[model samples]
Target: MSNRFKNLIVPVLAVVLGMLVGTIIMLVTGYDAGAAFSALFEGAFGDIYYTGETIRQVTPYILAGLAVGFAFKTGLFNIGVEGQLIVGWLASVWVGVAFDLPKIIHLPLAVLAAAAAGALWAFIPGFLKARFRVHEVIVTIMLNYVALHLSNYLIRTVLSEKSDRTPNIHDTASLKSPFLEGLTDYSRLHWGIVIALICVFIMWFILQKTTLGYELKAVGFNQHASEYAGMNVRKNIILSMVISGAFAGLAGAMEGLGTFGYAPVRGGFTGVGFDGIAVALLGGSAPIGIVLAALLFGSLKVGALNMPLEAGVPNELVDIIIALIVFFVGASYMIRIFIERLSKKKGVK
Candidate 1:
């Protein structure tokens, strides 16, 4: 088999194996595994409402996956996507609530603010790594807590409404989709999904066709070599982090403007950023792959809610399945080895 074929086979097998394992777990727990899966499918894609919800859930995952996946391509581990997301959420909400421009201008402005906030949040770790030689992983992990607390304080002190959320955004700043409403019975799916797709295309174009992307990859592969080649290693490293953060911030904007229309007090960290890690891994950090993985994760999440209500299965079982999928994806090398062995055996026969 060709290398490309093998590459495709690995992820497919990993998913199949993960699902099989999940079925075994369900059986051991005395629940009807088939029923649980049937409920999941029905909940996720059975009706227009369910499908719209699935797409809504996938929107943020797409952005977050792109953020982490882009960073990975540059050999950077951006553990601070969580922090950047929070910053973006706050910035967008602040702008959305404060402004009263026409929809064309206001919506884009809020999104831009979100991107800027996320990029700025990411710059701290990037700067520290580039100039001070601090480990990015450590800095990003620490910054996650800082962002959580800072956002919490802001919402409580400055942005809080009668409820534990920021003021509602102007209708002009919101990303409502009349088309989706007409088709899906007023589901929350909005223009954010379109934005996510556009971003994916842009990321792919830059990575595959731009000099800057080439330099970033070079630096990621070997800073010493990139510098010797007259590339600005420090600049590329910092820029990569900033771009990564921008994508993460956009993820938060999807929630604020597209879904919630306000920033709610996150009593705790939203797990979207961390879940991005899994999505990126499952997608192999490729643009198209990330989109597909995000859809899968989104469907699972949306469907999991139904299992508890319809099948008497615990909602946590869905989490277990997701974890299993991630674990299998991480061990994809094993799947590759098995496929190679099978191919060799077939050739001998």
Candidate 2:
């Protein structure tokens, strides 16, 4: 097989293996795997409404995945994406609620606030890692809790109207479009998908075509060599985290301005940030790969809801399938070796 073909082989086989394992589990558990999959497909793409929801879910997933993927490319692990997202959501809503500007101005302002908030939230860990050599993974993880509690407290003490969540943002700051929602049969689809796509192209352009990106990547590949070449390694490290957090924050902005129009979480974590890690990993930390992986995971999420409702399969089974896929992705080296061995055997014969 050609190199291009080999690159795709493991992922394709992994997907097939995941499905086969799911089927076996379903059979063992006394459920019809085909029926469950049918229900899943129906839920994800059987109709325009389902398709819209899947796209809507994919929107944030893409941004979140990009956030994590960007950091990975820079040799940083931004596990604090969850914290950054939470802070961004709160900041966006705060701006939206406090402002009464025209639509164009108000909307962009709210989004910028989200991005700024996310960047600032990530800056601490990034700075620590760069200046003091602190482990970013630990700091980012701890900051997640800080963001959750801070947002919750702020809502309770200041923004809440005798409720758990703040009031919905002004219509001018909203990303929701009446026409788009109607077009999707009243699903919560909005223009955020457009923004997500824009981010993908922008990230691709930056990484592949920009001088700054080249420096950042060089630093990631070898900080000592990059430093010898006169690159600002510390600056690049901090900048990478800031940009990564910005993308995650934009994801939270999507939920605030388009999906919910308010800041609300049932628990400490929204799980979207954590899901981004898996999405980034499965995508191999590539820009286009992140987008495709996000869509796949988004479909599974939307479809999982129907498995229990229509097919008598627990939704947790979908989680297992997802975990299995992640495992396969992580174990790709073994698959590559096996494929190479087979190729050599064929040549020898």
Residue 267 lDDT, candidate 2, scale 0-100: 66
TM-score of 2: 0.97
lDDT of 2 by residue, 23-67 (tens): 899999999899999999999998889999999999999989999
Worst 10 residues of 1 by lDDT: 156-165
Instruction: List runs of model 1 lying over 4 Å from the truth.
Output: 161-163
Model 2 error, position 294 (Å):
0.7
